[model samples]
Target: MRYVISFIWAFMLTQMVNFVLNSLGGGSPYMFWSGVALAVIITATIAIFDVMLKHPDEENEAQHNH
Candidate 1:
């Protein structure tokens, strides 16, 4: 479920970047780079949030395993 949400966020961000670039008459290479940057930023943000907001059960399991 987290993976799905991340994918959705990345996709939406990429599309938004593409749209803005297209409206400004950006070239293909520019659009590609914009999309890549957005993807990276989104992925990193999601990872940070996931780490900060861990599930209760996952935390318990980690403690037990350790």
Candidate 2:
């Protein structure tokens, strides 16, 4: 269920950016590449933030500090 929601959210965001690019002065290639770049950045950012939140490394590091 969570994965489904994430996928929908990502799709909506990507499409919104793509639409805006097309509306602006960008060509088809620019729109396509920008949309791809946006998707990759958003996905990576969410994944990294989720990981850090779920497992804070400072706690693990302190445990090993002994």
Candidate 3:
């Protein structure tokens, strides 16, 4: 659920960034922005997933921790 929401937010943000860049005059619209957009997405996913994984399951996972 968290990841799903994070992904949705990422997609929206990337598109919003792309749209804003497109509105700003000059350069290929989708050229560099596509990579920029993907970087934003991957960065967001990593950040969000890191937060989600911060707390270990004390009872189950801790028992198995090596």
Best by lDDT: 1
TM-scores for all candidates: the values are 0.55, 0.52, 0.49
Q: What is the lDDT of residue 22 in candidate 1?
A: 81
| Model 3 lDDT tens row, 1-66 | 766676667667777777677778564545555745685677676887786787756546767875
Question: Candidate 1 local accuracy as lDDT?
Answer: 0.78
Q: Assess the local accuracy of residue 44 in candidate 2 as a C-alpha lDDT between 0 and 100.
A: 72
> Tens digits of per-residue lDDT for model 1 on 3-27?
6678678978797868786878855
Question: Which whole-number lDDT from 0 to 100 does residue 55 have in model 2?
Answer: 60
Models, CA RMSD each: 4.0, 6.2, 5.1
Q: Give the TM-score of candidate 1.
A: 0.55
Instruction: Go through the candidates in order and give each one's C-alpha lDDT.
Output: 0.78, 0.70, 0.68
The model with the greatest TM-score is 1
Count clashing residue pairs per candidate: 0, 0, 0
